[model samples]
Target: MADIEERRPRNKATTFLLVLAAAAFVVASALRLLGIDGTRHMVATTALVPYFTAAGVLLGAIALLARRWFVGTVTLLVALVLVAAVAPRAFPDARPIGVGQEVRVMAANLLVGKADAEVLVAAVRDHAVDVLALQELSPAMVVDLERAGLDEVLPHRVFLAEPGASGSGIASRYPLTARDLAGPSTLRQAGALVALPGADLEVVSVHPLPPVTPDGPEPWQRDMAGLPRPDLNGPYRVLAGDFNATLDHVGLRRLLNHGYVDAADQVGAGLDPTWPADAVWPPPVVIDHILVDDRCPVDTFQVVDIPGSDHRAIVSQFVVPAR
Candidate 1:
């Protein structure tokens, strides 16, 4: 009787922890599903839905192993909700193989004009990138990039090189013509039409305002909503750069709904993180992306490390269907 009583407190404590874990899982799942982006911090938290969901699954499994049937079952159910939410992105539709010309694209944000020009140029050269989308470009960085022989690799270019986060540019091996896109007035997002041999592709370098302050959330939402949507029947499209939103963000998800798919997600690499490259721990979220239309089939997607930038670069090989 004495031994049983001594174990009772431990059992109660365990039960309490299990219940707490389950409740946290339920709350996180609900917040993500609900797509609440009303506040700045909430929007930032939304970016971590996948991580939260993953934690829930781990805790639920632990509960199950401990034979806490009721707690285990409830936690598992909550965890399952997260699994369902991420299933579409984690396992996207299979892409068609051997149907189009290959186009390799690389995108990177320069950390408000702080990325190394030589490192950026090296990435383009080493990766043999056909198109390079850069955000947070500055006049000085543009000069440095040009001096680093970026022009030799990607001769055709369109750029709006400014200071701070409101700068973007595109460099392509093929001819490029500037195209206007609707977005926030303050952000320096730019679009260009790349005239390929047999097909035309619209590539946009986007850098939405980060949601970090009390007034940042609304503009961030507006910036995402303002991005141009691809015409499914028209030219092939690719939107790349630091979007300041993750797959978990409803705004980015809504953008994807407009006949576009994330290149990394399509290739089963959706869980890779791309921001805070210099973090002490591994980056926790993927804010950079290569979003392509269905007309373009993704072959492979990779996240490349760039020195002096807070965000890593995304390199994707896309097969644009021949017109």
Candidate 2:
């Protein structure tokens, strides 16, 4: 027993380093809330930046525990700054910059054969959502929708080539001059832009292919790399369908780095769980999301459970007050 005790000699350096690492994590965690409004998702600028910093803390903490005292201390401090101070200042809070109009956008996955267009059409009409984005649009669903003739209902639409086996499309009640980010795309062609007449609000719809599987992290990283830099567009603010990477994903960190805010995280209400539609129970992950530009302050972000799809629909309402 005495020999065992000697074997476990107190290494003051290790002890101090561990404490520092833990404190760094605490600091990182706290910084996640700075200037955070807690009610937005499906939008990028709100939830992505701080979230990335939070993840870097976890990574840097791991590096700090590598038993090198000086290096550990420096790394831990850097992690703290990243999570706490840097993230908040780097990602500006979303403001109300839209023209005089309250826009409501709803995004849902019409799970191929399982989703009913009539039901979906009825819901869209009932809600009167200014913009409606749907994913997994099978060929039959398109035929069914055309048979029902929702073209009259939807004043404008931006439908590029079919989005994979499942399609991604946007239909708007307002006139929609379209823009497609086909090449400047990090993810698949789940992107399109809609211009509302006299509405001054540009809405960009997206459905980034999820970063699942372990083939290589780069695919995910590349998908997250070179995100929509609003600085490039210069106040050309808009909303994004986002398809938020899951809580466990590293891509969430990357999105945050690009200055995005998830409206769902802002609301402080319960989390909007909406993936694994084929699962047997509640849900194992929250994959689908909506992100908005910082200039558009959203009043509500709620989860609407639709029957046909595996994932629940996320609806966000924006009431941009005086800019």
Candidate 3:
């Protein structure tokens, strides 16, 4: 009788813990699904949806092993919800045949002029990147890139190369005409029109503030919302750089809602992380991206490592229809 009572308390304690864990997961899952991140912490928290999905699976298994059938069922349901949200990213989608200009675009954050200039230039050369969008660019980095033969690979340029992280720029194998895409952003988010063979591509180097800033998520949200929307009648557009927000964020999602598709997501490589490259803590997350007009077909997507930078560069190839 004594042993039975002792075990009963222990069983109840286990059940309580499991239920608490399940509730936390359910809340997180719901936040991601509904896209309700009002606070900076919530914004940062929701970026871990992929990790949440994995954790939910483990949690469900633990509940089942504990013989907590009800908890197990609920946790598994939450896991299912997460899986439904995340699984599609792992499989490629049927892309339309692109019989137009083939553009190899790449975006990299220079970590405020600290990323390896030679390595970045080499990536541009090896990948044959037609357009390179850069964030956190500096005038010194510009000189370094040119010294490293970036101008030879992608000669045309439009840059707002300040000394700090506020700077941004674009370089292209084709001619580039600068376009102002100024918004409520602390960074100089620059844009240019790439004069391609048969079509012009409006490319923007995007870098909205991180939600984890001292000012909070409002500025970040505003910047994201203020980003240029896709116009079907206009030239095909591509926005690339350190977005600082993932597809899971409502800000990014809202921007995507306007006829834009993530290049990585289009080809099932969406879950690949592009931030915190050199660090062990905070794991890694996909904060950088290449968003294009939905009409464009993405061919190949790759995330390349840049030495001395905390961000990995995303290189993508796609075709824009010639009008």
**Superposed model 2: Cα runs more than 4 Å off:** 1-99, 161-166, 182-190, 231-235, 242-244, 278-283, 320-323
Per-model CA lDDT versus the true structure: 0.85, 0.55, 0.91
Q: What's each prediction's TM-score? A: 0.92, 0.62, 0.97
Q: What order do you get sorting by lDDT, best first?
A: 3, 1, 2
lDDT of 3 by residue, 32-91 (tens): 988797788888889999999999999999999999998898989889888987888877
Candidate 3 structure lDDT: 0.91
Which candidate achieves the best TM-score against the true structure? 3
- Per-residue lDDT value at 231 in model 1: 83
Candidate 1 off by > 4 Å:
1-7, 65-67, 87-93, 280-283
- Quick one: best lDDT, which candidate? 3
Stronger candidate by TM-score (1 vs 2): 1
Tens digit of per-residue lDDT, candidate 1, span 259-307: 8889989988898889888684633688999999866788889998888
Q: C-alpha displacement of 145 in model 2, angstroms? A: 2.5
lDDT of 2 by residue, 210-284 (tens): 444344334444555535544334333444453545433445545555665666654542244566555745333
